[model samples]
Target chain A: MRICFYPGCSYASTAGYKESTEAVCQKLGIELVVIPDWNCCGATVMFGENKLRATALAARHFALTQAMGFEEIVTGCNACYATLGKAARLLNEDAELFIKTKDVLQALGLTLDRIPKIRHLFEILTKAMPDAPSERYRSLSVGAYYGCQLTRPHQFLDKGGYPEILETFLERIGFAVTDHSARTQCCGASHAVIYKDECRNLSARIIREISDKGAQIITTICPLCQFNLDQAQTGDLTPRIPVTYFTQLAGLALGLSATSLGMNKLLVSAEKVISRP
Target chain B: MNKASKPNPFTSISDIATINACIQCGTCSGSCPLSDQMDHAPRELFALIREGEYDMALKSNTPWFCVSCYACMVRCPKEIPVTDLMYAFKEIITRKRTAPKNQKMPDMYRAFSRIIKAKGRITESYVMALYGVKHPLDALKNIPLAVKMILRKRLEPKALSVSDPESFARLFELTEKSEDKA
Candidate 1:
């Protein structure tokens, strides 16, 4: 299956998740084409200020992907996924919004048809990864974290509170999934920089809660969440559980090595696990 | 206490979804990291908004302390989008200029926004430099703390830099365009 990928800003800097995702996709014989000159997702701020403009900004990506002849765009960042998903849903449901946004984009020599299906990377894997092991993943316990953006606002994807798509993906990859309460908890997100102390408190709380649930290393699809959780482990009291991009884990499951998957580059340090299996 | 109360103040179309989803479960207040630092609870603020008590809610510091983590929204049994409501409350506070007397936080976000308005994106160095210039005391307090943390190797200065300057310029233009349209 071929899909247009929007990596956003976080992908370039997110450990080796981007590289691993590409490598794994190549190995899996699935084509991952990145949208060139992609702009920001307008996360949190865009929709907060102007709904139409933000939707237009998001729709431009979808328009470009559609123009490139891809029916779906897979996003690695939860904020991007959520923003694009919300925009697509809004554009499809609200005609006036679609018209206004389309008019704005037309000013820049771009015209949007319909918003493409915006799928989170995990969703694509869940749909693509078969039941039987593909000789990549043997046996591993994977912890899937769904940050607030991916599931909130009562929009597309799974129900707001209880989401299962991500969990189902990990299981298919030959991993025992941990069922934890903080699955839907916040990871400090954009607030990580502004409110350091408070953000740390919340991030550390989520990390501890996840670690307590016996997750050796937590895996997430969001770049911001990974960065915050990885950066929050400041002391020895906190068990330095590393966070991995789901694609990076998928890269490993797809039989990619630690260095190839950028496992050695993790901020929280997954050196111990990289040596395992 | 008289049970007779006025209509809710958060009656705007922008706030109806948020207000409608509020279950009055008090989860937001309980989960708020800065609940102790604030004068009232997030639940109380929502209740005020739900009941159209905008004046009272708008007068409080509940809007300022929100870190925008959406923890309350995540934990809310009713799945209310609380952070957006908090953002609405903050925009109101900004318009009223009745924000907390301590101008540090708003000043910080404003400075960040100004960087976006000027450079078309946030400049970490510029923000840090501006932080030093505007609040020399904060800079002075932070320098020693940052130095100590740096020496301890606890802090890795990952400076925020935008990849495309032209795109950021376009973003600034877009911001201006939206304002012009408005």
Candidate 2:
């Protein structure tokens, strides 16, 4: 199965998102064609600062994807997934905004007649592995964190109120899925960089909630979510639990090497979890 | 209530009608993860916007603190696009002639966009260099993490510029024109 892949800025920078995603895709026999000349999704700040500019930035990517002739594009980052989804929805719904975006694209001789389907890599992983892995892991309890964007303002991926997509995936792969309420909570995202102290407090809440629920390893689909939960531990009151990408867990289940999954680079090491008997 | 003399800020907002749709049931504030840190929660912020207190809404720090998580937007019973409403406040506040031009938050956002304007893609290292120049002490505190990232081959010292600079420049120029109409 071949699909267009948009490895957003953090894919190359994130610890396990790119490595594990590629390794898992290879194991699953999914050919991920990199979107040529791909650019940033303009993230939240862009949309907050100016809607039109944000829409134009994302529409440019859409036009590029359309040119690639792929009807669907997959991304591993929640921010990119949400930003591009919002842009695509806005482009389809708002004729005025669409016209403005088309006019801007026309200057570059590019065109975006329609929005392509924006999918998170989690959806792809679930489809690729329908049953328990041949090489199953010890039932390590995993808290499947969806962050906020992946399941919010849109519930196509899963039910927004209480998302179970991650849980279902984990359970199917032979891990004990822990149902935590804060699974869809905010991680304070980019604000972690701007307002560190406040974001730390916000991130701390999510970490505590997940940890208190007996999750040995908190697995997530978003890079920023992993970064915040993994790095937000201040040694004050919160216990440091390992946070990792869902792809990494899937790669492990598929019998991929930890080195291939970039497992060692994780801020909070998952060595113990991987070595589970 | 806002002063009656000033033009209604609520009406001026593109999505202000959604503010009227708000039941003031406090779902937005309750769902907000950072409401504890907010001086005036989303409920009060909506009230302020409804009262034509755009000045208050703009200066309340609510919009700045918003992470764009969309939790509140999803939970709203009235189906209001609450997050977009927050962005409206940001846009309105940012447009004021006397708004703090170099405030660290918006400046950082503008820097991110400008990098893309110039290079057509964001380079994390470049963003850091530019941000570090502005807030050196803050950057210094994160040296250990930066070192870890560098050791992991995450920080590419030089990133290739976007394939089509001319097109990016033209699109960005057109963006400014769209902003005027927006």
Best by TM-score: 2
Error of 1 at A270 (Å): 1.4
Measured as a fraction from 0 to 1, the native contacts recovered by model 1 come to 0.08
Q: Any runs in candidate 2 off by more than 4 Å, and if so which?
A: A234-236, B10-12, B97-103, B180-182
Query: What TM-score would each prediction reach against the true structure?
Result: 0.79, 0.95
Query: Model 2 Cα displacement at B17 (Å)?
Result: 0.8
lDDT of model 1, residue A58: 81
Best by DockQ: 2
Clashing pairs in 1: B8-B51, B8-B52, B9-B52
Whole-model lDDT for model 1 versus the true structure?
Answer: 0.68
> Scoring only chain A, what TM-score does candidate 2 earn?
0.96
lDDT of 2 by residue, A63-111 (tens): 8889999898899899999999998888888888898888888888898
